[model samples]
Target chain A: MAARPADTPRGRVPRAEREQQMLDAAVLVFSRRGFHHANMDEIAELSGVSKPMVYAYLGTKEELFIACLRRESARLVAGLAAAADPTLPPDQQLWRGLKGFFEFVGAHRDGWSVLYRQARTQQPFSVEVAAMRESVVEVITDRLDAALRLEGRQVKPDDLTAMALTLVGASESLADWLADHPDEDPGRTATRLMNAVWLGADQLMRGVSWRPPA
Target chain B: MAARPADTPRGRVPRAEREQQMLDAAVLVFSRRGFHHANMDEIAELSGVSKPMVYAYLGTKEELFIACLRRESARLVAGLAAAADPTLPPDQQLWRGLKGFFEFVGAHRDGWSVLYRQARTQQPFSVEVAAMRESVVEVITDRLDAALRLEGRQVKPDDLTAMALTLVGASESLADWLADHPDEDPGRTATRLMNAVWLGADQLMRGVSWRPPA
Candidate 1:
């Protein structure tokens, strides 16, 4: 396949733009070929850059894969952060965050697959991906804490973290489901998750709990 | 490393017992080497069987991986089923299932990793692994439906399935976390999930919904 033109007037592309181009190519390649099978040679070819340029810009295939993960993760996190309005009630904030998340995943299916599916499965990248996931969880945990404080309700920090992690996990799994079933609406996915989590969380905040029938 | 004796009699072993042994070896190897890197030769060496024997018993590497997934998934499902007493209320049934799930993961980290972390990321094995996850979700969905019915409340069937999927995803993610932090209590993980999911579910059953503060 003929390479896509690399930015601008023809000869030399700016470093920033070139880096983005390489990352775009790397995400596609890594998503298509599982990390082990994906090669820098193909990535370079697809990015319309030389092999040495690819190395100079990204270091190694591992680094390039991590770069792709970080970029996609940052985009996702930033999108959620932008969508969540703190002034709004906690549930609305969560709804906005979920909507941003599903929309991002729906738009960037390859990025979602690479970060959540491919990068996560490999052992070497686990720490990096875990850190990314932790940041998202931390955001959720903070929100849950803030919401609880508003109601004068207290919960253990660990419990809050677990709740945050579960919310993140549920969103992720549903995002994967959304990724596969492209016809499914992201808004509906977001609503489904919001209903599952927020309603449950609101109950917990009210000190309501389910007990086994005697 | 010297292989463990498949059967102590130094003669032909029963097919069922021998299959279990091979499956155990396959789970370890697959978890360590991943499906692509894992080979029949290493599996045979680990299982104290010949390469031909490995193929004859399990068919091929793909089939062997699927067999391993099936076995692990079955064990997990069985454990949950056994723990969840139908005589108990739905919340308690869910609690029991979650407890059984965490206990199973804590006891069999390798099996959990293979079925969840390793097998799930690859494209070729998605269908098989998905089916395994679906069964667990189906069980959760049924319980949620039953509980809702007992409460004289009703929700869309699709919503019930979505809730079940979220719970499964949350539990699986927490299980992954439990596998990583070996010291973390599985019961605590289960409780955290029960709090996050069941509380919200009960609230929804009572027609409680969270809306943005006016």
Candidate 2:
């Protein structure tokens, strides 16, 4: 029988592959136990490596967590980027992006919690996650800007940024809601957001505004 | 000079007033240190009372945290309710509600953190905080539903709920953003959200939606 590559003893396992394995374990532990309660020993055991190896490769728990965050965040960003087609109109682009976001979150529930909830709570990782969130807001803002220009409606830069932030925040909150209610459809959730934000944004683009009654 | 009643020492201080002082200290300490790290001893010292007095008034650390959460959450709810006048049209009601929300959050930044950010992070308090969030969602949903009906538009209950959740979530994220960027005006932040959500909601009520171009 041929020897299985994955079954090879610890020292023989490639560094990159081993690192990936450790991270996979780390995500599960951190998601389940949170950053403070999660420990290295369990992560090592789950990764089929020893404690010493985890420390040697990943440095500290904080670094390991950051690595997990970066990995998961990159995956999400990559997923959204791949799904968003610049050639498409801004609404379609947004729809695709929202769909991709929900699908990624639904598929990677643990990753979603770790990146969105757990990382957000802990101080050390908040800045890292905030940067990732800012990039997302920037992407959405750019899309909105292009869309507005296409309609020949020029909005203030700050207004555009604020609108983008609200959209991102709304989507994130709905995504968390979706996570909690396992049976809910992500597509439907995405559609609901689209209906709520995009429709309003469309009206604003056309100069239709809702104001307080006199 | 007559000794101030509050300075008459712990045993003589009015129980209700003492409780409020302890909660004030708890909010500060909890917001600063988070739930797990916050201790009753510091809260007591900060409140100008003994640790036993804190225990007598607020109970265990978990109970005290919950007390702090309840007190802060109640203040916010009261502030919003007081600002929302039922006689006003729906948009204005929302505008006022949003204004009230931002003002409350802006004024009670520490309380906002304790209620929204800090309480949400820990396991024991998440459920408690979530219930508070649901009530807020419920209030918004009712407002949205009333507005839609008044416009003679009919929408699914679930869709209305989802929209309300999105609005609430968006406001929360922006409020956090407001917390970080202290220079930003809360009124403007409220206006920005109103422009994004209320306009979008208004369009949806009028049966206008943005769809991808063919």
Candidate 3:
């Protein structure tokens, strides 16, 4: 608690700010090296904090991993919700939402890939990923519901859930691919998905079906 | 190596047949109990084989698990490839393919859920899941390509890859949902995805876009 003579200036940094820096460093290292192979010393070095200090703040390796999962999940959920304006047209809203999601994944591809791959499949940690996914699905469902209501159209709750699930599933799949392909453009990926799903949604909602060409 | 007089009745069962029975038991036990909770004794009991025989045949627990994965993955991939006939129209082919997939997952829901959850995110085991996914993606891509060619329309390989990824991802997402919801019918699930995606694919391929309604 006491500031030594050598720790006066930067040591004055708030605990919260220092924690965020450590998380950022953790995300970077975890994404690059994976959880098992990653070391605390590297994370500390990256964060410019002492190893002892890192331990003091984050507790342990397992706890630090969970903390990273929580922060990353929160960031993804927040980014998605903020992307679409409620007042916008349905298609525009969907477009913005998809764009925001891919852009976020593209920017943090390594982190997203590592965190998602680890948490979604591993026990105890998967809960964090599930929570994030549920939040995302809810956001999309709300947007679609509001958009439908604007057109004086209402669908069954089951139908809405299925639609949201479809979009979410497809987006997650493509996002996984995007994460692996660094050369791929996030905006373009978003646009490609928008083109397919938006078109399909418009048709399906109106009771249209795709028949084989004659 | 010597067959006892007491074992004479069913001991005539061929080694391959007995191996198949053991594998069948392993799949059932693994699906129901999971790798960690499942014990070799239950599998041996189900197969009507002794614990030592099971161990001798399958080698070890980890090896048995991998064998189960290989068998399951082969079954799934074969099911998908066999579902769609080349003579059928593209839409029919796609419908059949999707139906086959959902049906396979439905029949083996517990197995798929546990195996996919465990393999896709974990070390070593994930390779099995990855191989299965690759096979599925390839099957879908070939179907799309052949169908497009029939109409004298061909897309860039990247576009095709993207399209295939979209379908694979969405189906997987919904499939995961189906595994959890035992009351849901896989056939109906397949139809739902077919309806949405087939419509989208047709329109998108022909240069049609969904514009926001005024």
Candidate 4:
């Protein structure tokens, strides 16, 4: 059953609804087969539309991938942004952000895979996905900046950026780990991370150095 | 130039050496091109040999990937294992082992990428790579066990394993972050981690945790 009107045939389907259906199918197919192995034919078939209809709505396979990435990236970033509370303390803000990340990935497994694994391999998609990654990192850096400044400690912007990136990577790696062990709670994951980063960082900011054993 | 002699060429080159070379090339190429995109032709070219030579030396593409993964996995294990001294206190041993992990990745970026990025994809590779990943988690568990025992604390084995996995994932995430910012020394990285994991873990073992700032 074609979601688009039969009379408005070929490449002329309603731009909005057609795009949504195509992206839904793209997420499913790409997650199952990955980028290189996934074919346009399968996407069209799964979307309940003809090949040309799929192409018209989504452009080339590359464009279809970008669309999928853009949609998912927006969803994740929006979720993180929405979860933030500027009124809350820095650690609480960071914890909310990390919890949102894990919860989002758990609920949207296919979307996360497309963004993290599938989009990373394809050429143009990688650059586009990376920009979204930078946005997320910047969000974390801004929070870390406020946190460190409150303690009268200031790290170089570059170090802050690296720390943000490390936190993001760690969250991602842990999210995947949590995926495998589904019984674990996101709150616990976030707590573990805060202990690793914020607690240690507070001590460092206070000039408390952990010395190596002699 | 062909490494194997004609008469004994069929089985000529010592299995260990040839296998090492093949894996070396495979890690470099696969890390760059990823699994599905990496071609045997390119791997053969990079290895200073022929396509047939790769097949002869390392079996199919999947097999070569496994070989590369196995080689890198062994190096990571050995590096950390040698550095982790059971004779030392548990905290010191964990610090040493994590330091070894960061240093190993710093010296071998290609191997790290192959093991982290490429191996997690799917199929014949994932089955073994997942196992390799589990062993790494086990190494962390061993360190956790020693540390907890010394402190006269007892916890569920599975909980410790999960936390250990969290630490390893954090280290790995930090490694990838450090790769982009080369100025961050592994010693500094190790110290940061020691503060994060060892200090917080020490506090947790003593049943102390920072509460919400109200």
Error of 1 at B3 (Å): 23
Ranking by lDDT: 3, 2, 1, 4
Going through the candidates in the order shown, the clash numbers are 1, 1, 0, 0
Q: Which 10-residue window in model 3 chain B sums to the lowest lDDT? A: B205-214
Model 4 chain B worst lDDT run, 10 consecutive residues: B204-213
Please give the lDDT score at residue A100 for candidate 2: 88
How far in Å is the alpha carbon of B206 misplaced in model 4?
A: 20
Query: Candidate 1 clash total?
Result: 1
* Distance from true location, Cα of A111 in model 2, Å: 3.0
Model 2 TM-score (2 dp): 0.79
Which residue ranges in model 3 land beyond 4 Å of their true spot? A1-11, A201-214, B1-11, B201-214
| DockQ-sorted candidate list, best first | 3, 2, 1, 4
Clashing pairs in 2: A200-B200
| B81-198 per-residue lDDT for model 3 (tens digits) | 8988888866677778888888888988888787776666555777777888888898888887887777667667876788788889989888888888898888778766765576
Give the runs in model 1 whose Cα sits over 4 Å from its true position.
A1-13, A25-55, A59-63, A122-127, A150-154, A201-214, B1-13, B24-56, B59-65, B85-87, B121-127, B149-154, B201-214
Worst 10 residues of 1 chain B by lDDT: B205-214
Q: Each candidate's lDDT (Cα)?
A: 0.77, 0.78, 0.79, 0.70
lDDT tens per residue, model 4, A23-85: 999988888888878999999988778899888677898888888888888888888887777
* Candidate 1 residue pairs in clash (backbone atoms < 3 Å): A200-B200
Winner by lDDT between candidate 2 and candidate 1? 2
Comparison by DockQ, 1 against 3, better one: 3
By lDDT, the better pick of 3 and 4 is 3
* TM (chain A) per model: 0.83, 0.84, 0.86, 0.76
